[model samples]
Target: MSDIPAPELAIATRNLSKQFDRLLAVDNVDLEVADGEVYGLIGPNGAGKTTLMRMLAAIEDPTTGDIYLQGERLDPDRPNPRLKRYLGYLPDDFPLYDDLTVWDYLDYFARLYDLREPGRSRRLLEILDLVQLIPKRDSLIATLSRGMKQRLSLGRTILHEPVLLLLDEPVSGLDPIARQQFREIIQVVREAGMTVLISSHILSDLAQLCSSIGIMELGCLVESTSIQELYQRLSQQRLQISLLGDNLAKSLDRAIAELRNCPQVESWTVGDRQLTVHFNGNETDSANLLRQLIQAQVNLYQFQIETDDLEDIFLQLGHQQTS
Candidate 1:
């Protein structure tokens, strides 16, 4: 009997780097996405997100490092036709034949991918329906709306039924409804066991769809973690208080210093009657801190504990890049 093969990761990068002359576009970035996961490469423009995605898609070569798809190391010497069959790439721009109808256009690529007979027609129709382009199957590519064209581009990418997808800014120009539709399509693809690597500046969209996120900054992957992990790592346990009173800043500062010196108080900061206290021990410590603050004559107008979210994490990482 033959030994069973180990399950392969959908995408993996080891110290991946790309340089254009002296400028490093992507610098020693390590990324991994499990099979059937929607992984997002999120950052602002010129953050090297596109360059990294292009390398993963095999459209461009990396100046340094390695990429593996399904446990197969991508190398120039070992050209694998199977790689193309297992990957789909949707660039930021959607190229289309102006004169060709939607069905004809998809059929053309389907043929190129060597889909034949019943399978070709069946796959094309299925993708058309998935992208909601069934009604416009016969419509000329030029006649379709921007949203429809985007969907058509997606359909073209998936026509070959590739297991991995690289989408660069897939929802950049889309309206709200179109964006929602695109998200739905992505969800369906995930359900079908397709691994996706999506690059987008829209953090909110990524926050909603991606199973994991990598934040890139200045050609480096500053942070890469699961969304829940990110939230937890950046979460704040201290409570914030606001006070409305005369000489609030001085009063607050003195109170905070006293609270900080307390055995139960871990640390505290105060500015303009607003105080933040981190309890060292537990709920008992927090209660002690609050009691101490009140006894110290720190007038508190409002108090609340706040936890950080994905946006907060992104901003914190961005700030680290600039500073």
Candidate 2:
């Protein structure tokens, strides 16, 4: 459905694939993640998410096809030493040096990235402040809460100033408040001009933070859509018309009888004074229905239209593919 041309892709894959012996892990997959864009990858378990992530991180080799990082082709066999400087991979279970203080922990990573002199200290301080761990710089990693540890791990990932972040279920175990805090950190990273490929089953969070999304099923990318376009394309609604006056039961019967044959209505529920129509049509159809009811002398008070939620659209897409 996307007709837009992609002239600038931060991470692009051409016919990417992977296989474990006779088992096909990832099918021919093509993706283009834009610069500074938060692209959410979602699918059920065993959807080849981890396989794809490993390939992206150069931990696993693709059987065929090319992976371009920042528009430069990456050869897994002879991975460019500079590639590590431009990429960061944070798995679901991010480990932290439990014995090291927050400052020392981050300092360790900074040194590993060869962040030297006063610039290293400046960058470490900036990441601490960004992750809201400035006050905990002296606190030991073992003493920090789960959410705090998550933040610290994230800070380590960006300690080297990587251009792209590959995060798998980054907020899986956080509480609501913690999740929001993590979201803020990602927003900050985006503002600082970093592209991210995040995989998670937490659809609501993805819906909120991601600019575009890729839906994978059976190792195939079934759909790729922008959040804006997805909302517009899948926004279906229901209309409930409430009637006025007495003899409410009679009114419902009349309305139901008249609407029983209308294709504009998919299904409906009738109450004493209300007719809840499961409408799969547009505003014009709604207006026509209202006019028809008015002309038939079925007095009504309220006509409410309600759009379906994101979960509905997500489930429907999966169902359609399987069906």
Candidate 3:
């Protein structure tokens, strides 16, 4: 009887490393990304995030190791058109044809991807609409703004509807509005079953978009996990308690006394009319603590849990520096 094949991952790497003379740009790292996942990569300026991605995109050769895409082994040294066809990579500086109009630019890439005739025209129109370039379809590439160019490049990247999308600092120079639009586009693609591997300095965006994240530093993958798991394991819960009453001092005193008796309350600080507390407890514990506080007549106006975000977790990890 024949053995059943293992289920394929969207991406997998084993003992991957890249060295440039004395510098080890990417160290021995084993990374995996499941299908239909949006994985965010983040680290400091010299953290080797870009190098790692470059190797994955097959733009740069790894000194050692193996890469697998959808269970098929990839050899960057040899031409693998089949594997390449399923990958869409948008590097930091994507080259565009300045002489071509928006429609012509996408048309050129469509032909390169072996898209032909009526279907090619239809796909180009759909891509232009997706990237919000329908109105600018006739505009010269050189006449477009930076944000428009970014979106256009993204449209080009997804022209062939690749299963794996790799974007490196795609939102680096965009303003808030552009970033939001780009983020929305990414969500649309992700919903369409594309596995995206994105790297950026914008932690907040990643916190919102990625199902999982990988942190790299000093030519190594220091950490990788689902966003929820990362938060549940590393994040500390804090409660902001605001007191309301004419006699604020008395309410504050009572609140402090109540907090002292609560074991879930690790520590707390008093402000003008609020208390910031470090709490290490579950939802039940929080409820009990609230009940106790209310019974003590602490005049509580607000009791809100403030969980640490991705930036906070990243800073707390202390793995920002490459060295």
Best by lDDT: 3
What's the C-alpha lDDT at position 67 in model 2?
Answer: 86
lDDT of each: 0.83, 0.86, 0.90
Return the TM-score for each candidate structure.
Answer: 0.79, 0.86, 0.92
Instruction: Point out the higher-scoring one by TM-score: 2 or 3.
Output: 3
Q: What are the per-residue Cα lDDT tens digits for candidate 3 across 92-172?
A: 987988899999999989999999988999999999999999999999999998899999999999999999999999999
Candidate 2 off by > 4 Å: 1-7, 240-248, 254-266, 269-276, 280-304
Across 131-164, the per-residue lDDT of candidate 1 in tens digits comes to 9999999999999988888889999999988999
TM-score (C-alpha, index-matched) for candidate 2: 0.86
* TM-score preference between candidates 1 and 2, better one: 2
Q: In candidate 3, how many Å is residue 208 off?
A: 1.7
**What does the lDDT read for residue 76 in candidate 3?**
75
Candidate with maximal TM-score: 3
- Give RMSD (Å) of candidate 2 vs. truth: 3.5
